[model samples]
Target: MDIKTATALHRLRLASIPEALSFPALLIFGTGFRLALDYDKLVMPLGIIHGVLFIIYVVLLLDVWNRAKWPFKRVALFFLLAVLPFGGLFGDRILKREEQAGVIAARARKEGTVNA
Candidate 1:
């Protein structure tokens, strides 16, 4: 894919990772409130949001994998990272590195074409 498309897809992949990560954090606080504070009301909605975001993150991961033609290991690593605390941020950095490199190559190629 072209650099712009790659960058956009990378962004989506990175964004989704955080959305997936947020779910468990919310769940922890929500559960603590329910058990410790005895506040159970409206806790279920956070779960629903988390579920939806998790689904979206999975979908975006699949899309980026398909478009980028990433190796199985790379994809698996990213998926695994999502499960770890603060792992999503690491994955985002990797994605940004790949995206920026692609963009740089694209620019060089375009410049070469114009110069020729």
Candidate 2:
């Protein structure tokens, strides 16, 4: 794939991971706030928002993974990150770096700037 397509897919993949993760965290933390701190407040709204984002993230991840032709391992890692708190951010960074590296390598190859 070209660099732009790769980059876009990488972004979508990155975005999907965190969006999928936020819902569970909100549910857990919101529960804590209610039981431990007696801070009952508007939690359902957050839950609703997270739920929507989670679905969006999943769809985006699928699109990106398919277009990018990521290996099976990478695809698995993406799913794992969706379930792990803060893992999405790390995944996003890694994917971006990898995409950039691929773009650079492709450019180098096209220009015959590096030995193959």
* lDDT (0 to 1) per candidate: 0.73, 0.72
Residue-level lDDT of model 2, residues 1-116, one tens digit each, is 56665766666655755575675668778877788888878477767877787667667777767777778888788778776777777777777777788788778877889776
Q: Can you write out model 1's per-residue Cα lDDT over 51-88, one digit (the tens) per residue?
A: 77667766777778887888999889887777666677
Clashing pairs in 1: none
**Model number with the top TM-score:** 1
- Model 1 off-target regions past 4 Å? 113-116
TM-score list, all predictions: 0.81, 0.69
Candidate 2: misplaced stretches above 4 Å?
13-25, 37-41, 105-116
Give per-residue lDDT, candidate 1, residue 115: 40
